[model samples]
Target chain A: MNNKVPNNRAWLLVLPMLVLVAFSAIIPLMTVVNYSVQDVLGPNARFFTGTEWFESMLNDSALQAAFLRQISFSLIILAIQIPLGIGIALIMPKRGWQASAVLILITLPLLIPWNVVGSIWQIFTRGDIGLMGWGLRELGVDYNITRNAGDAWVTIVLMDVWHWTPLVAMLCYSGLRSIPEAYYQAARIDRASKWAVFRYIQLPKLTNVLVIAVLLRFMHSFMIYAEPFVLTGGGPGSATTFLSQSLTTMAVGQQDLGPSAAFSLIYFLVILLVSWVFYTTIMHMQKDKHPHGGA
Target chain B: MSYQLENTQRGEKYTTIFSKVTPAQRRNRNARSRWRANCLLGLYLILMILPIYWLINMSLQTNSEILGSMTLWPQNLTFDNYIGIFTNSSWYMGYVNSMLYVAMNMLITICVALPAAYAFSRFTFIGDKHLFFWLLTNLMAPPAVFLLPYFQLYYSVGLFDTHIAVALAHCLFNIPLAIWILEGFMSSVPKEIDETAYIDGYSFPRFFVKIFIPMIRSGIGVTLFFLFMFSWVELLLARTLTATNAQPIGMIMTRTSTASGIDWGTLAAAGVLTIIPGILVVYFVRNHIAKGFALGRT
Candidate 1:
């Protein structure tokens, strides 16, 4: 509950940000919208296409497959990363050199570019010279990401886990640190079990950060590219192709402006709808606990 | 000890009587769990470092050595890969461009976001909630969706391939986050401070700079860290926006492949180099890192 005051002059403060963001977001979004409705044949030659692009895009079996694949990937990463990150955070040292070392080292994967993360995994999973790939082959597991769709999916998920789980851990660690030491002592004196302590004390304290972590992870994973693109190039089949690759292939690669623009609109709408649901649900949960009037 | 003192001060007689015998047993359990915690953390950290270790291993070897066989360590260790990056303008300038734009984006984002964040935290204005949500829609908007429009938008203004163009385009994403984080930190500041400053005859701008800003410096630090992260790590937009002059290091690494083959060693070396700036940024803000990540309304 912020208990914020009402002041119309505050709009003056927000005006600059609005202008800058609108310049970047609104103008381009309008361009996409324009393209979506018109069949752009050449620089000046165009025809009104109505809802044909949207109709076709909706009906297209490939786009539906990509949409389903996108949803599954997002769900899988969130399921794996959230709990794993929380576990890592709970066990992390609370203070000193070890803490700083762990914090920095944990962030190494996040610092690398998405494409390089892709490249790193690409090389590391190679059967010939790569460590994990060679090691797997040596163990006779038959791990070939380039030729196997299942292997490609597994590697992409692993790569994402490596790249992003640190973010969740960092968020949870911060949440945990904010807790007062007195709570732990009180729990200890009561002879609370470890699981009870976590369930009662840590989880409630971690709610805010966990919300942020989940929303961020969900959005980022839903829009994931570059890594999977470089690692398996959407691989052995179109099996690994997610929404972004499909859109990029349509929008930029094939230069099909009308349908790609329509796809972009629908894709943006799906994300907006999902996040709206999540945001409202979270807000409702928080409201029940604190019961305040303002944000 | 302080907790024990507080317990005794509260006249917690039953707790004190029972807790005496449990201390030794509890301490033993604590130590054992601590040991377990270390083992778990160590194993996780090693897995985290495995790919990085392999990258460093290859970066120190020649291309031929990398391709010839798999080795845990370099056989004929060399610095040619690193040397190539330093000696060449094309290679090194990519880093310069990336740092320049990242810094510029961070500066712009924080400046605009601070006032807006203060506004969001302190005052409810017209369409503020709707405005904030709309901005986040940009955050959720896929960069791939904006790819073509961005290229043309910049091109039309003759800002194409400029660092500022990349910086501005990045604002579409970073500003929303900056505002979100700063608003959280700013709201933690009580309304009484603003009123008290006004009572003392402090001007709005002066009070904000002298008092409000410093109070939320940790938030600002974390905001900078995240802004740098998103800007630096984003390739799809950065790569699309720049051609040659303002090419980011990520763009360079992907483009490093020659006709003969990809320069595996050089690419690995460049990847290693990219991680350095991030580490340095993090080190400067390490002490504030934990306090900083509490970036949402409670």
Candidate 2:
């Protein structure tokens, strides 16, 4: 550990990456910033409009509604997927080929493209042709994701869970696997009940993984586009129209690039800020417990 | 030599407290447990397989069969749908284009991420931790928020429809992930190796390429596979960034429902085909998938 190398060399290595990233990332960000402050009449026509788009985006009722709906959807998805994922992980076989088989099966859904997931469900949930719709009708449920707002909400939430819970379960499974056998043996010797073992040992050990799972699920679900776009098209009276859908509808469909760009920057900042808070808080917790910054 | 342990205690009326379990009864109990386990596992397997079975079944059936028949299994198994996709015009190109960009993105991500991760892992540079976390913020940011900027930016740069455009845009997320995964692996490596190389007059670039990279080869492989898979399956940005010449399979699936009613047959076929590369990558990296979820390992 007697290394005394100058750290300035580190920047040299990171410089190319930074430059490339800046070209694609930072420069575009600045362009968006520029556009948000101005207006584009056509390809060759433009005019400066300071804070106009930002003010409008702030007061836009549609954007507000979209934000609220997106927040609620994200919360609902997190509520359902986290517990369901943990339950599924807990019930998974402890060891052997059966465990491997279950892992592989669970991973299959995750490997499919998001649009394909939507298409599969879209076809599978059709009343006349899709199995879910047909079966629900036969069972007297009268389900139509396209017609009913509540149904659309349920369908979107369910689809999100189906697609994402595996990620949570996978993280939890790895966390569980890393727990030493000695811990389980100790619990057994202490005559800990199964519930007690889970509550006291397993849950505590799963904190970091679950924190990561929650943050990841929140970010991805909040940003979701293709699946919901395909499945609902932000329809049923805009019930499933989340923030991303709203932005797309404005920016691309309606060609309101100014407001959309402003909204997007704000949206990006919210996620960045929230993620930063979560990350720093987790690090602080780790430092408090480990006293060595978890290194 | 095994002792039977039961949760229940015998009543006081039981005369023989230490009664030996009969071999037949023990065999019956063992058989019952095994049967129970088998039944539970079999049921679990069925539930897991049914939806996938339905997907594949739908993919194989003709449009009429999918819409007209409620049969769980295809009545007449046909490869026409699958063939319909590849033989049709401009359809198969989606797969080729997606593969090309995904590979390019992975290559670019690894090259950028490896050195950045090495610097973050091995050297305590100024603003290192802050920069690392800043990169992570990019990783966590939603792609939708950046779609407009990405499009305009790429368009202005005259790279909007090019393969490199999508690949580089994707690096916004993948580079951060690659750095994180690689850093995790590199930090585990002892610093003594680098010091020894430095003492031997080996430069940083030479040491990193010839020595350090080989040591973290598995990490690189896993990161590459992950980057490839995520970029391959990603729909929104890829769709936004590329147009005719570089459209991915995801965009092709979207285009299925055009002026006509849904191209259900072709859509199904493309949907099935789109999953092939992801499945192949997952198959290759199945063993190391668990390692990437090492949340508490640090």
Candidate 3:
């Protein structure tokens, strides 16, 4: 968008990132690729299994279910967080000591370590000791995450919303702030209604930050593990055993490296594929961005 | 882009030209809307703080008090949990190790990502788009998937069980994020800054260090804040990479369970301590972050 100049020599600036990232990313990735195609019984024992592990993992019903659950969870999160975040951002105090205070208060939930977030929620939701749990029961609603799948699902979703909505809000808030005052002044001169100004000016301007927000929330929710692992331990049954939880069980708990590695590649591909779709579709909606038109 | 925005503005001009509102009426409506917005925001902040308040309550209470009926406030308030962490080596050392690696990761990520971001924002080099997308895929790569591979890779390199090992592993993710956010911020700065600086007879590195970096200081602050957050909260790689010597405070919180069963009181106290560092970091960058949030200038 900046009319970015074409210059291969610019790679010099990118070299440090390339080297550091390659050392950390490429090596581990190759190892995963190597493991995905073979069975290693021990240090020296290896059997080249070809795509057998990938075949089995793709056909596996449990992995299939976890994949479906991951999709639904991500959708539900986006559906709630995106619009709610925009509303909060729109309402956020523009500039003052008030803005600073609200920003810090809103960010508190995001700061806690994931597992500690789990622990805090764990004690905070007990019927005997937790405020929410006790207050619910005292008001005549039966609730227990350890016993009910529905309750477990609700708690996880609620906890996630509590922890993550601030991120969405913060992203949208920043986007809102970036709009120059002249645009609003022009709207006022035209006698534009608030809704007209929002629809015509603010929402279109928000597209870039919204893209980042949506993608991040999707990716982070997809990789979620610690909070739920602690909160429900994959629940009353396997009700809330998400993709990461499943993968960890297979890899660490049961030590099924071949299938797990194959599964990992598939998992990575799904995220990449979905993200690519999302990125393209959102970018496509604003076709004016590419003045050169489709090649 | 300008043509399209103007076109939209023109379209909207026809839809509401007849509506005439007095200035006083507009002010009245603003005050009313502002009140409603305040109400919603206030309610949200209260809900957000509830769980945190509960955690603080548990931290201040004695063991017996925690297990007893839910009290709004800790009746039998005690500071034993806090004292235990301060006096003990294992507990406090966890904080030390966590802080060490997180600080290292922040420094490494920022130093590496800044120039890369400048390049991405300013140029269309060969494979630039593909390279940018590939780096982001690192962020999408599940840390769970990388656990075994990371441990084996770090261990085999003989960098295992050291703070540097954890710091480097985190760079695999943090550097990509820093680059992405920094690109957004850098692109917002007008190109004239670069052209003018170059024309002033400044060498590339001197211009970058002297003028360009200062202009994007807010972006750098936000990037540092994020690096601190992700590195501090992440336990899987940190745990897998370091066993004893470099174990973080998060690991200690997980290990608090003993023969008497998990020490809820002590665990809560440690959780509270972990949050303090984040608060300090946020406070330091509060204003910079506010400016950094407004990313799309052009």
Candidate 4:
């Protein structure tokens, strides 16, 4: 992890990434910043608005509600998917034909385009035609994603879990595989129970991958747009409208560039803060623990 | 007396060994656990595949059949929906455009990310960590936030409504991810390899292309996979950037649903077709995906 070389010439190698990322990220980001502080009356008519847009966005009740909903939705999915993924990975066949078969099959959901995922769910959950919706109706559960906010929320969460849990499972499976056989052999010699083995061996080894999974899922879920947009149109009274949807509405739909730009900065900041916290905490955890004694 | 005591202790040990589960019991336990694992996996697989199955089932049926009855399987299965997509210009062109931009984005992301990832993995430099984190900040920035700006930016630059615009736009996220994933794989390779290549009198580019690239080939595969998947699946930016000529399949699907009432059969067909390319890619890179994912440290 340590490098003795102090050469700044390495920047040459990184220049392409910087240029590409800047073209895609930095310039647009700067544009957002520029828009956030100015009132764009027309192409030629503009006024410096200062922090007014930021203050107004902070005061907007709908945006605040969307923010809250986004947080809760992210928390719920991470809670469900992390453990479920780990469990699936734990039970997944370690080797042979079944492993490869399961790997390919389970990864199917991940490869589907985001809109297709939503579309697939959209059809799958239609009360008149789709299986899930029809089945729920036949069972007299009174389910409808279009009309019921609860149903919409549940459907979105379910769709996300179905779509993304495989990612976490795959990460954990590889992490599990990377553990040397000697650890398991040692656990067997000690007559360790299943839970004990998981706690002391598997869980510890999976810490790194789990951290990545949690952070990735959290960030991705926080910024979720297309699937929910295609599936619910951020409706059932905006019950499933998350941060990204709200931002899209302000920025693209209404063209409220100034406020949306401010909102965008705030949104970016929240993700950065959370990811930094998650990263630091996990790194700290790893630092405190001694390396396990095995290859 | 001593001999008798030793004999009794050996007998106790024998009894303890005998008290352990017989071979039949062990086999039963193994079977029970295996059965449990299979049941869990089977149930999960069904849950995973059922919606997809329903989608495919709807794709095979006519609109009337899909709406009129709650059939578990298609009753009057037809290939009309599939035929519709192939025959329609907009429908099939959507796929072509989507693939074009996605492929372009993958190429761009890997080309830029490879050397940058190598730099981050190998060398200490001025503001490296800050620069690295800054690049990643783009990953967390919601595309919705940049939709208006990107639209304006690309349009003003006269790149709007082109596949290149979408490809470049996708780079905001994919480049960061590629760098992150590739750096993880690169760092895992010992530093000695780079030094060894240098000592062999190979130039930096040659060593990089010939020696280093092949070493992290799986990493590259994984990076390509992530880049392709993200670029292909991403709709918000892709939709915002292109109106018609470069419109992605996702946009086409959304437009169809809203332009008319929901055309379940055609939509289902489009959805099914969208999944095929991904399935083929996953099949080829099945070996690398699991490992690639693990190597993509936070």
State in Å the error of residue B288, model 1: 1.6
Over the stretch A55-171, how does candidate 3's per-residue lDDT look in tens digits?
A: 999999988988888888889988988998899898889789999999998887788888889988998898888899999999999999999999988899889999899888888
| TM-score leaderboard ranking | 1, 4, 3, 2
Give the per-residue lDDT of model 3 (tens digit) for B1-298.
Answer: 1121221222343333433543454456667767888999999999889988988899999888888667899998899999999999988999999999999999889998999999988888889878977988898878998988998898888999999999999998899988977887887778898899898999999999999999888888888888888888888789889989999888888877798777888989999999999899899888877555543232
- On lDDT, the leading prediction is 1
DockQ for every model comes to 0.59, 0.47, 0.51, 0.56
Cα deviation in Å at residue A20, candidate 1?
Answer: 0.3
Q: What would the per-residue lDDT of candidate 4 be over residues A1-295, giving only the tens digit for each residue?
A: 3453667999999998898888888788899999999999898999999999999999999989999999999999999999999999989998888999999999889889898998889888988888899899999999999999999999999999999999999999999989887776666545556787899989988988998899889999999988998899998988888999888877777988888899999998999999778767764764565352100
lDDT of 2: 0.78
Whole-model lDDT, model 3: 0.85
| Comparison by lDDT, 1 against 3, better one | 1
DockQ order, best first, reads: 1, 4, 3, 2
Per-residue lDDT of model 2, residues A79-125, tens digit only: 99898778777666656777766777777777788888888888778
Model 4: pairs clashing at backbone N, Cα or C within 3 Å: none
Task: Give Cα distance to truth, residue A162, candidate 3, Å.
Answer: 0.5
Give the C-alpha miss distance for residue A295 in model 1, angstroms.
2.4
**Which residue ranges in model 1 land beyond 4 Å of their true spot?**
B1-15, B19-22, B296-298
Clashing pairs in 1: none
Between the candidate structures 2 and 3, which one is better when assessed by TM-score? 3
Candidate 4 lDDT score relative to the true structure? 0.86
Residue lDDT tens for model 1, A172-250:
9999998887887787667666787899989999987898889989999989989999998887888899999999999
Candidate 2 segments whose C-alpha is farther than 4 A from its true place: A1-6, A43-45, A293-295, B1-49, B196-203, B295-298
Question: How do all the candidates rank in terms of lDDT, highest first?
Answer: 1, 4, 3, 2
